[model samples]
Target chain A: MRIKKLSLQRSGLAISLGALMLLGACGKKVAPPPPPAPPPEAPAPTASLSATPNAVDPGQPVILAWQTTGATDVSIDSIGPVDPSGQKQVTPTDSTTYHLIAKGAGGSQEATARVTVNSNQGMQSTSNATEEQLFAQNVKDVYFDYDKYDIRASDQGSLQADAQFLQQHSNIRITIEGHSDERGSTEYNLALGTNRADAVKNALVQAGISGSRIKTISYGKEKPFCSVSNETCWQQNRRGHFVYEK
Target chain B: MSNSVRAIYRASLIFGLLFLLAVSSSAQDWIRTGTGLGVERVRLAAADFKGSNSDAKNPELLKTFNDVLWNDLDNAGIFDLVSKSFYPLQEPGQPSEVNFSVWSTPPPNTSMLAFGNLGVASGKVTVQGWLYDVKNTASPQVLGKQYADNATSEAVRVIAHRFADEIIFRLGGGIAGIAETKIYFVSERTGHKEIWVMDYDGANQQPLTKLGGISLSPRISPDGSRLAFSSVTKNGWEIMMYSFDLNRVVSFPRFGGMNLSPSWSPDGKLAISSSRNGYPNIFVMDGSGGNSHRLTNDQGPDVSPTWNRKTGSQIAFVSGRTGLPQIYTMESDGTNVQRMTDQGYAVSPNWAPNGQFLTFSWMRKYGPGEPGSNDLYLMDIASKQWVQLTHDSGRNDFPCWSPDGRHIVFQSHRSGGDQIWSMLADGSNVKQLTFKGSNTQPNWSWK
Candidate 1:
């Protein structure tokens, strides 16, 4: 909820700042710069923008050069405010346009330059991830309470998600590693971990996943995911983790 | 009384006195009182040995020997080891250099003194050791031993351990010493949990398996010829055996379900907790994993079976049939089943070498909001009375008794990691055995 509110406020401020900048350009021109004699009417701002190399490969840098006269403030749309008459280098991941606006005693004048980015072919569909990586990404872990083997009510959703993934991939066999927090003895934790693994296995079976596709092993408290002596770390350590077996 | 009976009684009395002079008739009393059973402790002084020659390895080997000897005796639980600062300026290397009057009085007033000398010649190291009685000036030497081995650091340590055992046996009432025994445990030093072995004094630590996977509950065979442990394999948790002679893992039949914590009966039979029959229960089989017989037909998990090392008639295990894990013992046929623990969680039931007591990890008050710890406890089977061996240090577990029943090797998290530790049977003289990686489930070798 806080994140949503913060982002909304940020966008609202952006809109108001954009409107203020537009109104400054449209309003009466400011007094001309001090000179021996002031001009009868402020000279209308003149602006020109150009890209040194208008086309390039993805992630390549492009140079934007702009010149403006009779303008006190100058800014680019995406690149933020910039010097009135200067060249700036920018790397564009995709094809983009550089929009520069100059405002002064004269009405604001805008100039735009576009940079075309070449797409790298054959890199989109080919994913080199192994089966184990895919398994880790798709399957989730089931957690339990301290010294209790029965699955937690909060973890039911996670177990169901795991079952759904396993059901979709019928040929994949998995090993359920039951782990425990380092509070009790190794032997008792071993048994407790075993029951935890078995409990998950039973849950998955009841959810329509084949029992033959699963195997269980208990690491007891031998291996821990976190080492801190607190509940937050212990909660992470006590889990039924999944591994994909070929 | 008959005349012959009266004459025999007098001769017996004389013989008993001579026996007392040689072996100390109070030996039985000290053995009983050692290890927290009583308060009396024998005052013993160990003097630094004088190097006979200036060989290059003499200093190193002598230091190893002396350190091993001193640690063995001090860890024996029956001796009040006198500090070296109180020793006389002149130490004895041989019987002729003995000055009993100085040792028997004042600062070094010790009843027993152990002094020895080490020398190297012709690529062989020789050690001459003696245990002397400073109180009895006439027959001062109680034990004299000479050992010669190849001039190596390992050989020197072995010789020292042998000499220490000789002294311990004579003074600790015929209960053989455990100074030379080995401890087999699971060490993760190599980035994988594998079986590792170390000397009883924590020297010469080495790994026995390179399976590169998670292995738990390593149980060395009764004869120390093979190691049986549970490892995660292609087929899941199975009982895997490694032969010490072949120096590799030997194949064993895989039980269908999860099999763990394989223990060896005194007669070389194997007992394990297997779920092949639907629920985890105690099962006994031949050493080669043949003739499998399910022992416990309970409703919950029954695991960590340990046999009576002395009688081999009863098997103690951890079961959860009562809603929480507890220690239970059953006969070989699984007929006379009895629950040993009446309170909170208990597991890792290991029978003492003497077959009268069991030492296991217990949490007398388990669950959250309770103020208790998981400590090792020793309980007498007949009386159901137990004594807490460890307190407030860390989670101590998997307490296995040395073959002599004088000491126990277990794992503790006291030093911020799971490491193997050993203490006297009475829970005194605690020593950390393995410092490197996480070590647990230490099984002392039968010998």
Candidate 2:
């Protein structure tokens, strides 16, 4: 969705293009000096984004996370924002976006989070969805090494915890989808992905989960979360998806 | 075990100790530096060599079988030189068959049993073979093939060997698991295909790099520590060095197109292969991935280069400024470019371990529509003579000499599958190394 919006906005204004290089392409390879910087700039001092779970109805224990770029001080004006001196409780009016307010010598800036939220869908995803994620909680992407199927030692601990929770909820069966960066062929990636999922399955199995309870499939180089071809995009794409099923 | 496997096994032992010796095993120690297997999974079955064949077949090819007519089913080595006391028969011709019951059953406790025949003079050769159950010779299992005049003696040898393999494959019981070795090749499988590694039978084939991004002709380094390939990855793809040493990869430092075919510089210092100013040409780089020097400025795609360890100055590669891909050689620094074969189009040249002759592929024009036929050809650089290693079955390309120079592993369509096949260096004793997926690109690990 964001890609479509980005594309439309780019095409509509004929601006900020990446590949076609509307502006950058013209100036390069020639003596033409780069055009002067335009007076209008993007929201440069955009505020940081954050979220905090406030209410808990038996299962929703809130957690706090923030994204900050330009400021050091953050304040919540309604429930009013967090004050170092003690004001900490605030009711979430919408999906939480920690309001960050700050003052710089040159200017003043306030940042708001682009925290969009939707309640967990009726059915959990077969891969890449967490148990708590059923409540629509935030989760980060898991990564893998080139051609490696085993989960990193670092990721194993968290995966173990996830496995334990799944064990507690016996009604759930999960599918671990293996993925790979577009560095190799589709079939090879598929096999590599399968290897990765198998690794994760091994881990879950070793951590007291039954083998039959878990299943796997490799979507080799097919479904990439990130489309760029560089290492970063490859890193994002070389990932195994976790979906919780009930 | 393949000679190189033993060396790698030792090097890896050095590798384990090198781990104990850490810091030094880096480029300075010259260890292979590519990603290695993560964990060890030992399968008693894979390690099982299945031992040699049963020493039971009694009726052997006699010194006297007649020459006869041969085939249509199509198809398709231990050494040592010393005059023996037994007076082996004169060179063979189209051999005739023998019924087991009438054969000269050798004396008891015979130290040696020679059961082979040849039929060269006649328009045909018949190799009559049988499985004498020794104690049960009454119901012997017989098998043999008759070859037509056109059957190169080489095919007879191939047919004969296949006959041997059948006895072994059957007597040895199910699949020797050989039906599974892989073949590695540089295929235009994907346009701009680079050096690719696959099963000896070419099953799970995947490119080592799309990172070479474009065309990258690769050759296994002499020390068996790296793959020296030319790539456009650098800048427009230059030559670069890659080590099979690192257990994990860290050296694929996207070259600026400064690296090219990397024939280990004798002492394993520099690589030799074609590079470009604008075309696929020859160039050399430090085995350590530094100090690259362009050796050839030929306009055509000068490729498939091999290094002569003995002469130091000898470089062999295929150049096409003459219109078609043919074998060409030069001095260490690229001077004295010499064209070796002038007959049929021959390309993909690799040194025959001993370095006397370079193995290459030649296309014969006979089958059908310009029906290009690719066959393995080995030319003796010194003799100015060439020998066709394979024929009729199908195109046999990418010949890699075993480290001992005694055996050569190559890919062929003879078995109706593009699989890797091996034969005596002289092109006798052909055997399929793989039986599964189509395999190609055979780089013999040097001992």
Candidate 3:
């Protein structure tokens, strides 16, 4: 009701002003001039960019939230262009500042939020216990056939479980250690062990794990889990074990 | 009449002495001297040195020096060392005390006699040694040597080795004996396989690399300044070069694969077997790990490369291209491929100093359900005719040629665990070198 009354009053004022201008023009000796209309006002641009829980531990993820008004194009620094108003999850390895720019007809407006990453010392000391538990309880040893590096059908389920666990704990890094039985040449066994570890790594990568999160090592016939000379012991020695980094 | 007869007798006597000298000198020439039917072993006698000083350590040092010298000459495979029990009761401590008739007699007939005087004072030892031709009564001394150092066990051993080397150089037809060379091998004494170095005769065994991981296939550089071996690291199987000058492991770039069995070229470039391309192949790189180039491109695994020290133009390796691991040779540029072994599993080919033969480990009948015996075999490269040097003893492998090409050192499991053993090139005079903690893969130093 207030908006309607204001419009009515504005229109009435406009009509009275027009009538006064007409009378003045008629009294003038020269021809009446044309009345001028006011120009359209352009909208001002605005932006609001912020990080949810702006402080985080190392290798932890943070959510970036942003909103904008009257923007034809919106962009975030270090993230390229994004939607005008949306949220994104970023896992920064170090402390970072995110800048958002909203551009419109009036001009551009910018907003920034800094995500602070805690130092590496305290986190390292705390993560060791959890990492040890993860390695001891979750990671399993993958076995291989004699003189072979291929992933056997029976081991696929265990490997899948491992991959899922790795995905869940994205901040953890692991080392895949390959071993071989004491039957072949030391050098050849070393190569075979590497192939075994690489096979495991490839399986993890195929299951949507990053290669950078894993490393591989071969202990060919050198570090045997079982020293007995029998098929049962040999099978036990030929394996791929996982070690977590603290 | 009396003066003329006397002059004539003097002339005849002079002529007779000249004839005797010519005959003795010719017989003393070691190159032409041989046993009844084959190459004769030089008969040598090492007398117990007399102690000149009573420093409480002189007797022990002298006994040690005498025993070491005797064992060195006896193990040289070219000498017939007279047993000390058969030696004359009189112990000659110097040239003046050496009675030629005692050593040249029938009971223990020796052509050469070694006598010396050893003394210790204020933690220092001095040794004066002399080698003499027992048959040449007048001017019997052939070699005179003097050595002095701090009275440590190492110093005593070194002095003995030096004196023994001098004797071998004069008696073994100018071929230098390996008295001073070291054999680098892998031992599990520390609960993990580590690179250990010992004297050629297995004395002073010490660990060279304490990586606390499996380290194997230790190949000492020709210059004896670096040792190249493969160890298990977090990165993978990497070739680690241990610099003797730095006394620590130097940096070797990780080749991103299974790098093992590094063999230095005659020029110090390292040739290693790597699986960087998903197949085990030979890759040659500089000692500092630069300028890498592939030497073999085959689907089968190629490994255990040994360079021909004579020309450095050829390499011998083991390849599985023929369905089983066999010895193969190719030029340094990877051309002119030639397979040396026709059948059986042959690996670890070491070329002789003359480059005329190759010694390797072979299983005559290799495969499942076949009776196989791993033994050392020597093959004439030109004829491809091989002679099994080791018989139905235990598993014998990793045969390396001595610097003088007269002997071979290898690892044998005949006595229960793998131990380093050395034998003549003809597979005679087998002597065990190391007995502790399963030693294997011995690399004889070039010098």
Write one digit per residue (lDDT tens) for candidate 3, span B96-184.
Answer: 78878988986779988888899998888999999999999988889999999999878999899988988888887787878899999
Candidate 3, clashing residue pairs? none
Model 1, runs deviating above 4 Å: A1-141, A151-172, A222-228, A242-246, B1-33, B36-39, B54-56
* lDDT for each residue of candidate 1 in A1-246, tens digit (9 for 90 to 100): 557555544544443333222221122233422433333577889999999799987667899999999987687766656788999888886556666667666656778787877665313311555556656755778877667778866468667878987887788898888899978666667767777888888999999999999888778787898787755567678889888888
Q: TM-scores across all candidates?
A: 0.73, 0.38, 0.69
Q: How many steric overlaps are in each model, in order?
A: 0, 72, 0
Candidate 2 C-alpha lDDT tens digits along B138-185: 543333333333325434434444444443334322222122223345
Candidate 3 per-residue C-alpha lDDT over A1-246 given as tens digits, one digit per residue, 9 for 90 to 100: 557555544544443333232221122133322333333555878999899789998778899999999887687756866888999999876566676667666656778787877876645654765766755655667878666677977578778979998998889898888899876466666666777888899899999999999888778787898788654467677989888876
Chain A accuracy of model 1 expressed as TM-score: 0.49
Model 2, A121: alpha-carbon shift in Å?
A: 46
Candidates arranged by lDDT, highest first: 1, 3, 2
Which lDDT tens digits does candidate 1 get at residues B177-266?
888899999999999999898999788999988889988889989898998999878766799999989989989999876788999999
How far does residue B198 in candidate 1 sit from its true spot (Å)? 1.1
